[model samples]
Target chain A: MSSISLEVKDLAINLSGNQVIKDMNFKIKKNTLTTFLGPSGSGKTTVLRAIAGLNQKIAGKILLDDTEIQNLAANQRNIGMIFQSYALFPNLSVFENVAYGLRVRKEPKATIKEKVDAILKTVNLQDKEQSYPENLSGGQKQRVAIARAMVLEPKILLLDEPLSALDAKIRIELRNQIREYQQRLGITMLFVTHDQAEAMAISDEIIVMDNGKVQQQGSPLEIYTHPQNIFIAKFIGNHNILDAAQLRSLGVELAENDKSNFIIRPELFQISITGDSSDYMAVSGKVKNISILGDRFEYRFITENGLELKVEFLNQQQAFMIETAITFYVKKDNIERVGI
Target chain B: MEKHIDRIIAKIVITLISIYLAAPIVATIMYSFAKSWVNTILPDGWTFEWYLQLITNSDFLSALARSIILGFVTTIIAMCCFLPVVFYANVYDESIKAKLRFITVLPFTIPGIVLVTGLVRVYANLPVPQMLVLLLAISLLSLPVTYQALDNAFIAHDFRAMFEQALILGDSPIKAFVKVVIPNIRVGMFIAMLLTFTNAFGEYVLTNIILGGNYETLKIYMYRLMQSNGQASSVLTTVYFFFLAIISIIMIAIMKWQGSKKAEEVEDTKKL
Candidate 1:
């Protein structure tokens, strides 16, 4: 299997006289899945389309295995794309839809049949071989879409929020199925989605973007734990953002003087009934609210200075009263400084 | 009980409307078959003599052939010219729909005699034959029918996405259009052809006012019979209705066969 590396350097795009993507850059190593996670109009879908060569008038380089493809047509680029609608040919049967790419390439009949059958089985949709798109459920249509694109075995696959149209239950079910296929085939894949939890769940590397620019790109854990900026910190996880002046006044050292924003993860702060001396700084606050999630509990606290902080607790053995005061401690190392 | 009452009322209304619409055609058909029914409750004698006159008339036969030729020619030209135009407008400029609607309804507002008169002057200097000019005029008259059919097809199917999907699948744009887009919209195209052809076939005013006796069509031949044989004109109309019914049945059969296939596919998917 030949794994192709993808690189987009200083890429920019303007649609109808408006700058939609501005100086975006990213690279994907071979045989890995990277997701562009952002809100709508954040230029994530446009970047994916640019890489797929669907959008013209894009500036800068898009390289697949050292070959510049920005000027190439979509067909010449050899990139597979699954649209959000699944865009299955409604007239064709599942077998025929999967066989479309090979048939168009003028592969022999026997080869097309063999490849299509194998892919249908991989998607676990072999029983729907003779079924048209209208005859299949939403989940089945999704599988057929993946099978159609992957059967071509293009250099890279780009998916534009393929699961956004599905319901919650099928979305999660098909999500794992896609990850399994991508890993098993070792194909280079770039998936775009606006759902943060979905990005965290399936992405090997998540590229968080906002305002038509890349905010940060790292492993899911790294993005959760070490968000590089204030936008990313707030976007990725529920973190208490406080002024560096408050931390410094509380006897914590400053990383830089000009940047005043610091972040602490909600789960990193430990809350207790007693305000005891510890290695970390301790602060007391009154419990404002407590919310019970499926497997965890979140507590909202308001300090003496009227600063609110959220702390999460997995073990809910100690029930703190709503108006009672509790002390929450955080290590100095858990404090992450971020730029505005 | 309320639902049952509503169903009965709807059935009664539909039956009443059907009879109201069918009454004129029934009277005309009975008149053509009557031998002599001047003031009686029904025809005193029924004869096939008028029908025989219609079949034996050479002018009428030639006129029927001419009308069929024009129908096929006009419908074919309309479809060949407008499919791509409709597809382009749909994909590139959606605002073209308003323009299309305007042009489609324009022919209806202008009297056919007026429209044909304007046409003769415009082509007065052209070297084209009057017959060719007539065909072109009729095609233009039915342009909206063909264009609307294709426009509706494009609206129903997202041809842009299908085209893009085909290109990504390694087919050229032309190939994708020919193989995928055309087949998907084939039903709409067939409907367009049939509608335009039917309009061109029954057209009387354009053919009568411009081409006149020089190029007599089926409708023109029927008009000529009104002077000499009023009963023959009724016979001609009855025979024309028969053929129309046959053609309608065949077209409906084709549409239903294809339509049911699609419907079954949808229901099957639902069952899954």
Candidate 2:
């Protein structure tokens, strides 16, 4: 059997008169949670919708297990989708909502009940079988939506910002539950979210998108540490990006032909007063601003050469005041070269 | 003191408007039971003789029955034509709704008399049944009310998501619509039907001019009696008014019930 569960090749979509997605390509390994992370209007949701057959693509080949499904209707594709809105049928009880697909497929009443009951149990919503959607909390409604899609045991599932409408605590709780279910069921899942933190927390692989194009596709840590371009570097994490001129101003000597931008994460900068500059590229700067970021203190530091950079340090009992002189160093191995 | 004076003036204005609107209906109700109402501020005597006569008359009963049939048929036809169009506009192609704006203004742009005149000119020499033509015409005229009420149903919920979810759950488009969409929008459909039925039942010019006396609807019978028997006509008019009042009451009751249900749903969510 093929290890890849789903793939898209040379996809292009034009909505109305504008090209929304252009030549998009990617593949999902079986049973892995891959997230399309981007800012809003980056076409992540549009790409997810196109894969689910809810959107029309002007040119594309969407394959499931290496078989083309781009021409299939949405229902025939057997692709489960959980929308941002839970989209539970208001008139149907929880059990009925989950059993709707089974009932539509003409399954026996006993089998439908068994499947719905089992799926509801999996989602920890067994007690909510008789409850209507209106009576459930947002978290509970989303559980029912997931159960409704999972009852059919689809080969793959698409979740389009399903937790975006939820509260912070519920979003954290539900995303963990989603990851657990994906692993337990071994279902290939494509998650679309504009939240970088949520995507990093839940995804096995992250495909960062910007302006309807894929910027980087890799493991969450890989994408974070080795962003393919300046956009990804800035978008994925709060990396301090320095162009060649800025690098030169920071007293960093570059090769004659080396003209690449350098990216160093805010958290990777080590602050010290006694570190020898020989072992690391060190810059002396004064703290310009301090921000309390819960567990970390983010200090905006301005070097003597007028290069502004952000450096994050773990919160400690002692605090540094604004305008306090500080020296921060980045190891040579930690700085990454990226494209514009 | 100025605020107090403003409140008093507002109350007076509301009271005067109420009286202005209710005076005619109040007088008609009194006149329906009056022994003789003219040349006096109040009736000299009260009786149910007009009511009894109207109830006993076969023509009045048949006319009522015909008007009811007309209302029902026109409602069905109008729903059949407009429900799918409205659902498509709301769910899939919202651009179609922009083109449908002209239907809301149809009655104003083409009055019933003018519409009937055109219909007679076109279909008079044809072999089609005039009653069917009248039913279609009444349905077309009631489209504005039906369309607006149906459109209001699409609000308050993410129907597109609900529908697409159903489709992904192994339902064909039609099955998804019938299974998911219709149940959610049934209340709105009922409201649209009620409005359309009321418009058709109370339709005067189209029915009278198109079918003449062949189809003597309630309004036509009232018009006939209006020319000869003043007391009986008043009684018929009062009955018609009560019929409309009952429909209005039902509509209001449904709206109140729906509002309470929504409040209960919100309360339920809060409790969780």
Which of the numbered candidates is closest to the native, going by highest DockQ? 2
TM-score of chain A of each: 0.94, 0.97
Clashes of each: 1, 0
Off by over 4 Å in 2: A273-277, B1-23, B34-49, B95-99, B122-129
Over A1-340, each residue of candidate 2 has an lDDT whose tens digit, in order, gives 9999998899998888899898989889999999999999999988888888888655979999889988988898989999999899999999999999999899999999899989988889999899999899887888898889998988899999999988889899999989998999888999999889999999999999999888889999999999999989888899999987788777677886778999988988886534555657788889999999889999899998888998998897566899999788887677788998
Which pairs clash inside model 1?
A: A135-B269
TM-score per model (chain B): 0.84, 0.93
Fnat for each model: 0.62, 0.95
RMSD of each: 3.7, 2.4
Interface RMSD of 1: 1.6
lDDT per residue (tens digit) for residues A1-340 in model 1: 3344898999999988999899998898787889999888899988988898778789999999888999988888889998888878877899999999998888999999899999998889989999878778888888899899999988888899999977889889888988988899888889999888889988899999999999999999999988888889888889988897777666676676555688988888875423435557676779999888857888898877677888888855776769988788887778887888
Candidate 2 per-residue C-alpha lDDT over B1-272 given as tens digits, one digit per residue, 9 for 90 to 100: 99999999999999999999999999889999999987999999999999999999999999999999999999999999999999988988898888897767777788789999999899989998999899999999998889999999989788899999988888898999899999999999999999999999999999999998999999999999999998899899899999999999999999999999989988887898
lDDT of each: 0.85, 0.90
- Top-scoring candidate (lDDT): 2
Q: How well is candidate 1 docked (DockQ)?
A: 0.56
Residue A339 Cα positional deviation in candidate 1, in Å, after optimal superposition:
2.0
